[model samples]
Target: MAQNQFSLFKQKFFSSFFITQALGALNDNIFKSALLIFIAFRAGDELGLNSDLLNNIAAGLFIIPFFLFSATAGQIAEKYEKSALIRKIKVLEIVIMALAVLGFFLNNIWFLLGILFLMGFQSSLFGPIKYSILPQHLSDKELLGGNGLVEMGTFLSIIIGTVIGGVLIGFDELGVRILSVLLLVVSACGYLASRRIPETPSAQPYLKINWNPITETWRTFQYARANRVVFLSILGISWFWFYGAVFLTQIPNFTKVSLNGNENVATMILATFSVGIGVGSALCEFLSGRKVELGLVPFGAIGMTWFALDIYFANPTSSYIGELGPSAFLSQDGAVRTLLNCAFVGIFGGFYIVPLYALVQERCDKSHLSRVIAGNNILNAFFMVIAAALAAVCLGNGMTIPQFFMLTAILNAVVAIYIFSLIPEFLMRFLIWILINTIYRVKKTGLENVPEEGACVVVCNHVSYVDALIIGGTVRRPIRFVMYHKIFKVPVLSFIFRTAKAIPIAGHKEDPELLNEAMYSIAEALDQGEVVCIFPEGKLTSDGDMNEFKSGIERIIEKTPVPVVPMALQGLWHSLFSRKKVNKFIDRLKRLRTKVTLVVAEPISPDEANREHLYTVVKELRDDKP
Candidate 1:
């Protein structure tokens, strides 16, 4: 609906909600960053404790609340109207910030740690409401963009807050006073922004509340696992948090000890990473064509691992002579490479995370959506806690920070492989994505004519061997394509076809049993309410021209009687995958990045969806383009 993710800022409802959530993130990071710095620098002197031990303690304190409170929070989000609930949470933030001010003024480490726990608690309660409300407000077409904007805003706030907290907390008492006042102001502003958010009605108004965190937590995980893809998406998301926690948690020390950089240098590296994520998040709408494209997940995983491993090799040892400031650090050997690697890691991380969030929001049942998000928060916290522990164990066992980073990167690749293997959808989509983006520039028209949900048989004129992949990648839903049995078994593409659950059919002379099996499967798919795409001509054309309609489509309609949507693929005839070969060198060269179009016409009723009528519709849609 909107032109892009940026256009979301123009609407009052979206803008206000964005500001409210961003401010909340900002305040959380400011307080947490200030506390971590205090514990690292000042708390050790005052409390006579190991700074490292205290820092670990501080991290655990913040994360413990999510494990303890996320279940109850998910239920609360589901059972209440969201806007008012957000306002109340913002008010609670004001209260928490007030306590934070008292702790800062008194310079009490224990009291401040308590406030940190409370901050995490507030975040736990807000997590479900934060994500689940987007689907309620934004159209399906806008979901990816909306999530992208939110991710960008959240990361930007994180870096800004981290920088502000690090700088402000450095000035001793004056810094404490300024931070105290700033915290209250930001909290107040967040509350005011919350007040402007439009009401989001409850998804489960009559649902009973679960008070026990232990039982409710287990039940929440079950809710997440209700949909297998959604569950894997949550796991993928959690793995990202683990990867991020290891990298981000070690940055300050990584800069200080490994790079021999001062606090300012550490802040600069963190800022670079955060900014890269923001840029990547903002790029998702364009890259995914405003759809929840799972293809980007694998792409992002590869980049995250590549850049993270580069960070290890860029500076594996703490060999620098003296503590360098930001400028001097930038001038060091391999410094720019290290920073760029960090930035790309964040960039790919943004690409990895945004779509999964959108997928969870789109696929999960609305009633239990909030709870599933709560499960996500619980797992995220669990992973982060494990990351911290893993870092401690690895570093304590005589591993350098760079070695730890290398380990995390290697672990990321392993996990990505494992998850993708479990759900080949991610990899299949990635393959399709690469095929379309590299070989062709696709321009789609009338895609909205296809139904968003329910059973429908799409009739498209087949032009090339890769026609199914193009159609599958372009359409917004999963499609079970029917293809010739021999073509279905074509080596590499066979994996994609099987993963997509495509039905393979044979002619009566070739294999009558296979033909009967295919028809039954098609009927079964329609009975279960899925989109099944079939080429009415029953095979690809040798030349780029329409073929006569086959009556098999009529039998499909008679058995299932679902609405049939007509579609056409144009410009693909010239592709290398097509049977037609180009003898001219210029024509061969032009095959790369060929411009292609896929056109869809309105759905026709079953009674009118004869092979002849559908063929005419597709031919007209493809007119002058092929």
Candidate 2:
């Protein structure tokens, strides 16, 4: 009768984070769009600045803070309490909003440019704290939904801000003044929302501050490097930003040139992209069935390329000779069609980015989470800058907009191939998964009977080390298996298993550090839409008898909305790894009676998955005969 973990988010985390983050995004875009428009209209002649130069400078200014300060910020996040940091950042936003008002009043382009840099600095400082604190406030299961909400909220705010900025500036002097004041008020509201974000204790209180950006950045990379899959996933995330920046920067010109519409038309194009991203972001929770589904990354990337190329091909041949308003373009058949194509591309983008971002957050080392995220932000900035420059060069070299669009699509295919090739783990997991599907038949009923995908502790009777493998192999989706760190290093199996992205858990009483790693991974995996699968029995069954279900599963389910999928292995006790108490030599016999059936029971709600109930269910399933 208990509500799912996802419902907890609607009641608790959603409004606080969504409103705060969205307002922050809205404020950013409103100011940015207004400034860009102002520069285009009023300052161009006075400063002798061209559109491209101004834009490049804006991009440079925005990224400079990330390069200069993300490392220092990462350290600060590790050293201080997070809610206090959030409040402080929000206060800074108030001060920055005042500066925005002054800049607008003075009509000074340089002053406004400086404010852009400050906003970027503020965001960079907030980055590490924003991600690291997630593990503290939300349970493992709410991570993905929380992240998806954040993504959707951020994009939704962006579209709204852009539309408001464009529409407001069209009014006379008083309207522009009103808009600036509104931004300040909204920023203050963001601060108010921050007050609601619960406190998060520092991960590393005594960690030394490293002022050197290069060293700090390298250290962030090093921590991530220790985990190969984590490192590659970081790269994948950065690449997504690069792909996004390229498409985003092109829209203004694409609208003006391709659609031959004025500024209003340009705003509509931007709106489409924003809507697509927002829709895609929200869809992650559902498509993934509330688990961090990485398979969607490939699916999203494929959509990005498909629609991006389609946009190029959808280009209308007819051209207008003179300047026309947006209404003219809307009347043209191809214009609306092209815009929809671009929007669909954005929707796929959501699918591509949300899960991967969640994956990185869930899988990385917890202690150094802030720094790793900081490192990721730095790389994301670098890639975005590179993408912009590359796009500029390609355009300057006489590539038509459609040609450029086509090239990006082609490049996506190449980049996808390269990354997946480098980390064949993604492909390997899919391959093994495919093999499991083709080579063997799997059937289940009560799976839907499992509490509809929220955070709940799964309790399974352990028969073999392959218990996790068989469950993983048979499940319709990926699950983060919690195992002893040592078992994670087993021969061919270890290599294959690690690539499938299993979490290694060491008991806190046995190894504090490994235990810390396990908790962080579990929290992160749940956040990202991955099923955190653990053998509550803790170790493989030495005999056919079930071990006592541990309390760890209970602790995890209590925190998140993930449901408990109870499972039992039948017949695996007779296999090679099963116990033969009479003699050790007798147990060493090669595989015999290899047939195994894994019975999965209906999901138990967090409220229902108590130790006694779970043990009873698993016992019944394990004892069931073929």
Candidate 3:
């Protein structure tokens, strides 16, 4: 399915793993909801515990293992084959579920709580395996689609599990028996499916198991932060979990006390949120054109804050003793709009999470991938705990849910802007992506001519200031541009160039040291197996005619004997960045949505990549459509 992202789900490994993980998620939600509902509604007063408070306690117990055992789990995943470990975890799940059967039979709250802790432990172990295994089985392009499917499966399973568990626990003593039997069967099914997952070799098979969670946790955290982007992405992902936990937890009481709805109405609201998540996950791959697009992250953050604000304003002040059925709720002013807003929040959340997870998988060091993921899980658990506490603190201080929603929405905007400011690359790429896609209808020919791997010198006709932007955006491979020093410093475009690491060159007559440094940077980039791009024409065309090619290409190829691919840009001079009409910025803005075409020619061997030879090739290609 490397050729087709959606077909990835039809493959054997992805399908089996999808089912196995989905079942695990389903079993978790089913057991958790059933137990929580049982405690809230049916647990006898003999225990002498507050139902609502115990509910929160149960939630905390389930996440505590993540904080304590994630390091050990990471080591285990690193030290052993993932599929075998998954099978063993599943078998443990069966045993735990069997124990849960007896605990439910006796209606023993302590025993059930213990089972909940074990379930959390099981999930903690599974978390590292869940993400790290994707890079091994799927291609980079397939990572986004695979993650989308996994997210869809998880949320769809949550909806089913929540509904089924709610209904089953609604029964009398017979419900306990039925719930126990059902959990046992689901655990067994998960084990069976785990058996079918293809073997993925351990990333660190020779690693020693570190049993000390505290010390090992510190080491894992260090490795995770070693990469700046990965660490920042972890923070963004954690914030999403924090946002989600607070929003979802308030739904039940908000539905009952605020919307005046019973359990049925609450279920409908949850189902709507889940449906929206599933839709967003399913559509992400197509929307991204099967790439791990970072642009969607900001797009998602924008929608999330907006929808959250809408939810607050939708029903700013409303409370009732009785209930509004689904029909009556829809009849109320802004009721459907509120539900839709909540649903869209989940939808954008899918966009926010899928790419970040895929980016980590694609970018993180393979040896420490599991540990990084474990650290991420730990941090996510920590942030979620903080979110719960924050919500409690606010409500305890007399903050209404509507007011809290407004506050959280405002906070979300602040957090997003701060994070984006720290890593302007996300915002820069987003702007370039939006500019290219919206301002120009870009067409490409012979994209296959560009090498898919290894270092190559991409020599292209530089007709406009945004040439690198267009080429980099459309090319499958990441390229480092060798660009003009002045253009590379054009305020907003400077951030774009610097973030892309575009080498800034000048003639020796102007700045000899800067030119020399740029040459070395180009060689270093090539040596590191990156595509190094140069505008051999040296400057943007003055009359839509090719200039004499520079010796810069020949000089660089002499130091790094790599393949040279020649490309041409046509239909660009009339736009804003060109000299067609004095190259005014406002002029380009006026011509937004103009058409441009990029053409790539076959690569030339290093020995044949002379200034004259390359110049002829580029000249011929540029003159093709002019």
Candidate 4:
């Protein structure tokens, strides 16, 4: 496995695909930005039209294609090879740019706006294939990193392309000529890059095409909703886009009216926000240990809310005679704080989005992934439209941009709490993430031994009260642990345990009914192809020593008849949650940041998973470490 996301750049396949997609994003933004800028500045005089009305029309035109053609695009992507499809899309971009050159030369706003609609049409077609192809080429471990790089490249391209477009359009006829040439060249380069993407076979080649947008769109949504987690993840991703659109659309005006800043200051703030998103997106691979870590989603949400609120509070009162330039803006009181707020909000937005994208890819059925992504695109566009309307309503009603920012932040908090409440897994993973990251540096080995799918009973030597948590956090898959009822009821930890759906048990003499129910639950979980981990010792070790494995493991394996994997937890005995005696305050200090290791051994066949054999295997794996 590649140790870091950067290593992926060294591979030709990933690099080619990344560049192709990034350039595509760049070209789309460049064209759209140039047209928007022209509409804002020169179009009203040249075309004798209302600029605001024209701007809204342009925005509406661009978004309409996503709604009209996304379902058809999804079906087409599923039925054909992705690489060829990408090259064709790039060719279409070249044709669109050629027409755009004519539109610019003639100074015809209607013609250019028509070209803008075509750009959106092209993008809607490419959307499904863009994400679906990643899974075809990348491994499960590379998925998160690949997504992070793509997101970083995309946002950076948006910033760079938008800036370049604005700057190029500012010059006279010469600027129009230069912009036209740049558009064609970028489109050609994107085509060249697409040529190098390794061929990916169709996912559902035999499927019939659905041409009707209305019915097909409904079917696409049903595909997305087929998996409950994936559906919610789509909603989460769309919500982020909604949140992001609101912030991005208001930045220029906010800088002008609220910050008393010139165009240069606005550009500077926009660059900071985009760069923050890039940095945060790149950091996801590192923070997640190259897996799709859902914990980062909640973490990202909290940061977005906090920083957005700060932006509201960071609004400065100092009045300038004229709009300040970039340097002057920076010198103004509360400027840096506002910039920091923008950057952190962007960073958390990255964290909020990347994992959800990965999860959608990882969980959605391969055959329907393209369609599901198409469904996501439709929702994303819809949400962005709503965002625009909301922003207009709020700003039109005399709400200060800062107050609007505050309102957005508060809405974000409410939405996040509601989503996490609906899917407690995100919150549960967050708590587990906090515990392991803060108090322990976990080193996991032989995790590949755990089966990627299907039922398996994992038996670990229980050392401390937090062994299950450590194991739960480290493993890539969700696990239902059979734990002691007493430990399950621990004050702070109880919430996490119950949310995790941990099975609680007691001895026959202690509580026979509860023990039988626990056993039945474990068996049923395995029957449903879930992973169930149990401490075969039946409880935490009291003296930092291995206890004899109980016959419960045998009984469960006999009932389920599944593979049994033995695991060991080492170096957690002295941790704060352990039963180890701490005689002094200094001893407590030593427990912080303890180095912990979780070792997973190969699965033992059902026939060989007896009490004695499994105990010896777990002991050997622990290497006598407490």
The prediction achieving the highest TM-score against the true structure is 1
TM-scores of the models, in the order given = 0.97, 0.73, 0.93, 0.96
Alpha-carbon runs more than 4 Å astray in model 4: 316-322, 624-626
Clashing pairs in 1: none
Q: For each candidate, what is the lDDT? A: 0.92, 0.76, 0.87, 0.91
lDDT of 1 by residue, 308-332 (tens): 9999898889555448998888888
Q: Of the candidates numbered 2 and 3, which has the greater TM-score value?
A: 3
Question: On residues 1-626, what C-alpha lDDT tens digit does candidate 3 reach at each position?
Answer: 55566687678898889999999999999998889888887664657778987888799899999999999998888889999999999999999889888888888888999999999999999999999998999987688989998988999999899888888988978887788889999999999999889988999889988899999999987887888899999999999889988877888777887788787888899888887887888778876767787878888888889998988887676466538888888888888888999899989989888888998998899888988899999999999999999999998998878888889889989998998998887887687778787878888788889886899999988788899999988787888999989999988889888988889999999999999999999989999999999999889888878889988899999999999999888788767677777457776577778788888999999999999999889887876443
What RMSD, rounded to one decimal, does every model reach?
1.6, 10.9, 2.6, 1.8
* lDDT tens digits, residue span 339-428, model 2: 888888889989888877777778776778888889889999999989988887988887777778888888887887787788766655
User: Could you arrange the candidates by TM-score from highest to lowest?
Assistant: 1, 4, 3, 2
The whole-model C-alpha lDDT of candidate 3 against the native structure comes to: 0.87
As for TM-score, the candidate ahead, 3 or 4, is 4
Supply candidate 2's per-residue lDDT for 501: 82
Worst 10 residues of 3 by lDDT: 314-323
How far residue 291's Cα lies from its native spot in candidate 4, in Å, is 1.7
lDDT tens readout by residue for model 4, 1-626: 55678898887778999999999899998888899999989988876889999999999999999999998999999999999999999999999989999999988899999999999999999999989999998888899999999999999999999999999999978899899999999999999998998889999999999789999999888877778899999999999999999888888888888899988888888999998899899999888877899999999999999999999888833243337998988887888989999999999999999999999999999999999999999999999999999988987887877888889899999999999998888998898888999999999999999998999999998888888889998888889999999999998788889998999999999999999999999999999999999899987888988999989998999898999989998888878888998989999999999999899999999999999999999888998555
* Clash tally for model 1: 0
Where does model 1 exceed 4 Å of error?
A: 584-586
